[model samples]
Target: MPMKPAPDAPLCFHTLIHRLEKLKLNYLEIPAAVVQQLGGTFNIRLQCSVNGAEAFACGLVALGEGRGYITLSSKRMKPQGLQLGQQVAVRLWADTSEFGMEVPEELAELLRQDEEGDRRFRLLPPGKQRYIIYHVSGVKSSQKRLDRALLLINNLKQLPPGKEDFRAMLGLPPREAL
Candidate 1:
């Protein structure tokens, strides 16, 4: 069964939306006081809910001063009828899952089919592994996700430290202009 957001998951709050300048992506600011309350472990995973929707594994961004934020993908927002600048309740818990998020069946099967890919994938940091899993999960089509997973795995043999190279090799969009 997919993990559900726990009422006991360390923290819960109502946050206002904020847009990343230039990128135009919308996100929810996780307050610094809350971050400090969570012991400043910004790299940690959380099972998060925006409003009352089903929860998904979320990672907190830890960049500059205003960096404690969660990306609010349209996929995860539409069903709940969310909008920019709206205050919504968010529940967050420490994620204890093996992959940080639930493993997409497509990616899992592809990994199982290629031992070398599996080895290389396991060698990546847990966060990177989850990023791959989450990236594959972003698409609406199972076929597309499977296709991306194949390209990602095959390229993992010599892929570099940046996501853009992987995105280019996978024929996907660049995440940032940088």
Candidate 2:
């Protein structure tokens, strides 16, 4: 069953898209009241719809001008054919999916076929699982997705020391401390 938000949750709203190019943050402004209730977490799992297309998004709510804003990504924008200045009908609730996004079939089959990979993959946190799923799902070609899935499984099988190490597995260098 889908996880429902708290009773009378202020999670439902219609907002206009606003842009923040300098910060690379394009988002809808969420009400401060909702932010307070949500504990001001930037990475809040949301099951939202853009226009009419159903989308699962990780909302980044940032505080500004004594209010709150929910950031949207280009990835979600592209698929939904969203554009700036369009009205976005967003109805958010707590994320209930095993992975924040849907697991691609190509990757799913790969994990099922490889026992070790399946074991290790399930060991990682749901966020990490979503990271791998999102990355592999970005490509168009099934061959590429399979190859990326294989690569991810191989590294995940190694069991990276931490999140930073997990990035290294994906050929990403350690992030510099801010």
Candidate 2: C-alpha RMSD after superposition: 4.9
Number of the top-ranking candidate, with TM-score as the measure = 1
Give the CA lDDT, 0 to 100, for residue 3 in model 1.
Answer: 39
Per-residue lDDT tens digits for candidate 1, residues 137-156, read 98999999998788888877
Q: Give candidate 1 misplaced runs (Cα > 4 Å).
A: 1-8, 63-67, 140-144, 158-164, 167-178
TM-score for all models, in order of appearance: 0.73, 0.71
lDDT of 2 by residue, 1-178 (tens): 2233652453666888878888986787776655655665556666665566665556555667546676787867887778887887777666666677778899999988999888888877767788889889989999999989988888777655454256755855567842
Return the clash pairs for model 2, or none.
none
Candidate 2 TM-score, true structure as reference: 0.71
lDDT against true structure, model 1: 0.77
Name the runs in model 2 displaced over 4 angstroms.
Answer: 1-11, 35-42, 60-68, 75-87, 163-167, 171-178
Pairs clashing within candidate 1: none
